[model samples]
Target: MTVLQWTATLVGLSFALYIGIAIWSRARSTSEFYVAGKGVHPLANGMATAADWMSAASFISMAGIISFLGYDGSVYLMGWTGGYVLLALLLAPYLRKFGAFTVPDFVGERYYSQTARVVAVICAIFVSFTYVAGQMRGVGIVFSRFLEIDIALGVVIGMGIVFFYAVLGGMKGITYTQVAQYCVLIFAYTVPAIFLSMLITGIPIPQIGLGAAEQETGTFLLDRLNGLHEELGFAAYTDGTKSMLDVLAITAALMVGTAGLPHVIIRFYTVPRVRDARISVGWALVFIALLYTAAPAVAVFARTNLLNTVTDAPYAEMPDWFTKWEATGLISFEDHNGDGLIQYVGADAVDGTGQPVRNELTIDRDIMVLANPEIARLPNWVVGLVAAGGLAAALSTAAGLLLVLSAAISHDLLKRNWRPDISEKGELIAARVSAGVAVIVAGYLGINPPGFVAEVVAFAFGLAAASFFPVIILGIFSKRLNREGAIAGMLSGITLTAAYIVYFKFVNPAANVAENWWFGISPEGIGALGMTVNFAVAGIVSRFTPVPAGKEGRDPAEVRELVERIRVPRGSGEAHEVSG
Candidate 1:
């Protein structure tokens, strides 16, 4: 079979497996629909969580960013991976102990107000929708490139698969399917890196190979990459161009935002106990680290290979991969002097013919990971594996996001607010309907992407950090934070963050908005600012308003009880069910 045919068959088989699993494990109640019946083993939950957390951006875009940006790209690596530490230490245990099916459920019960629940639902939908848009777009890109299908048709096929599993099985189906996806994606991601690493550095372990001496240059792999980058007028591989303060702020935003994402947070609810939740995060990080650590290796190898291939090579002899990617508009080169020889030099260098050689070769960063194996002239099977991995990453996250979107509508908004008398069967139908609607919206966004995938995803994270993280954290830890404060804080935080992003992303003309960002901080990294505003607004508003009455108020006794329960170890053999 041709590469496209093979890819189609692999992807189709994977989808069929997921659909079969979903039919077999369809949710039987509201509890199962929302939290997978809370019976998932800690290790299994960890794998599922890893798949859910590492979306299309992580799988397809991150290594590519690192390849071009060098050390500056460490922010995404450090920010995304480091957040798990925060999740394991501060967030997961307490949330699992809270014993709620959804994030909105926690907000409503903790704040003792339906308004707070509604606000949480809205925030969840907003974050999930923005995230799902990128995932669907990623699916389309993979399908179009590997399966040779039209982009819109690819998106529709992906949407149909996600809708089938998510609507049929809810969180239960998604969790198991995510485990399988985690395996597919990780295998797809690491195999090429290992092959490339061994070929270039004579080391089998890509992570260590990245830091080892290069076989050709006899210098550290990173040092060689840095030298190459300097020659090309790019930033040094080990240093950054952004200010330290901006780096600090952006990293902080990503870390907190990762911890705050509603869909990620809800994964803890699937586990059986608070301690299991904590342990699960540790395992999730371990699984994620396998890919995370290998990514830099892939980046360095791909960058070195790319530079070596095109530099001084005859233009007519450029590799097939180069021409193919150029056709996709992801890779481009211009022969300014018409010498038929490609010249890649520092940004300020004069051309080989004595004319100024401006950095005019434009290559999209996303192509780095997807096109790496092909660029390195690896076997076609390796390229096929990467295709599978990219699809797995996109589909797994899309399924999880769609599940949350449907739950927000059917469970939080419809059943809780609009139709309190709805039965379990009716609620299930509502969830399916909501899933169908969400799939349509996500597919549309995928076909007509509004912005770059990474940038759009970062906006979603910022929104989630600003609106949901503060409310959930404060509700659990601070007894004095009231429902009025929670609702007001979320609305204010989301509004401010959205306005800033819109202005910076769409309105401002001078900034390139794309490159010249605010104080060197990109829109993707501005969640820290929004989060600070959220905390300040919530605190000030709460102090001025009277404490809520009854269970909503500052109940020292109940607070102590909840804390104690959360702190209890799983080995204590105490029942893990949520006891009101």
Candidate 2:
């Protein structure tokens, strides 16, 4: 089948599956709606969490970034995956033991203040909306290219699918549908990567294949990539040009940011026990590692293939996929000396006069992963699989983020505050309405994206790390953190980070000096710095102020009892003990 046919068939089937799951598992109560009735199997919840966490950025843009940036891209791989370790170790289990429907609920009850809860709701909405915008745009891009639809119409179609299941099934619908999406996306990502790996290096596993000796060149695969990069005037693939301090800061920001994201943290709430939450993260990582490990290999193979095919080949002989992508204005070729052949070289290759000796081509880095299989002469079905995978990644993440967005509005903002006595049915309707509103907002943002996918996603992660992670961690672990301190800390962190990013990314066009950065860190990594400042400020302020009466301490007996129950395995047929 052609790419369009395969995309239509696979995407249609996936949508049908989601609708069926939503119908069969329609949430009947608030608990079911928010946390999937708290009966989801650990493994199943793990798969859903994997899908929830791996957004369109991971599926479509990560390898492309790695391809263009080379070793600098390792920061993303390490930062994103390492954050799961922090999640499992520091946050997930305790939140599960708290037995709340959302992260804000835990913060409110733990801190004994509605103000803290409201601050958390605001943070959740900001992080979810910023992150979901990229997913919606990714969905539109996939549809426009593979489904032969306009990008705006594609976004609307994707929005409608999200509305169908997210409104009806809530977390229950999202969880099961995410499990199916995980399967489709993972298969779609890995199969083509394996094919490319075998074709290039004669190795099946991309991770090992990347390090193995190349059949064509007697050197290691990475060494070959590095050699090719230098020949093309680009930085070596195994070494980075960024300063050590910047790399460390960026990695730190992404790690803490990953742990702080509301959508990911809320996934732990769906499991039945604390141990399930802990073990489920390991499973989620296993699934994530499948694509993460393959991504580097895809980057190496695709870059090599692109350089070989386009470097000396005439424009008329260029591949069909090249013409197709170039028509979208994503790929371009310039013949500076009227040489006819496209030159793929680094920016630094130009002479001291700031003029190129050869023609330069500029290709959008985002197209690398999507066009890799086709560029390498892989079967049409493999290209179709990638399209499906990209859709699954975007749709699953959009559903998860939309769920959090609606819950924050309905449960935290309205049910908890505006109408404390609102009926469960009323709240459910509110949640659906909130979800519909979020979809419209996300669709609009997708149609007119603010920036490139990876950069925008990084900014969102930085915000989450700086503003939310510190608040949630201190709320649970520090008894001295007062409502005033949490609010002050979040406001300060978010404000400072936003100002820094806006100034650097948009405000100052002519002044781009590294010395202007505070602490020698870029705005991309400054969120970690902001988070540290927040924690210090909160700690200092809490010391000077008196703790709210009756809210200064956790029940030690209850805490111990909860710990013991979570430590034990489930299905023992005994009533779990609780103390207060």
For all candidates, the clash counts are 0, 0
- Provide the RMSD of all predictions against the true structure, rounded to 1 decimal: 2.6, 3.2
> What's model 1's TM-score?
0.93
lDDT digits (tens) for residues 1-580 of candidate 2? 8777877888888789888988988888887888898888889999999999999989888888888888888788888889898988888876776677887776665655678778888888887888888898888888887877788998999999999999999999999999999999999999998898898888888887787887887788778778877766778888888778878888998899999998999898888777788778989989888888888888888887888788767888897888777766678888876877777777556655767555468887777888999888898878888898898999999999999999999998898778888999999999999999999999998888766677677788888988889977876576667767877888788778878888888799345456788767877788888888888887887778776554333443443344445444354222232211
| Global lDDT scores for all candidate models | 0.82, 0.82
Question: Model 2 scores what on Cα lDDT?
Answer: 0.82
* Per-model TM against the reference: 0.93, 0.93
Q: Lowest summed lDDT over 10 consecutive residues: which window, candidate 1?
A: 571-580
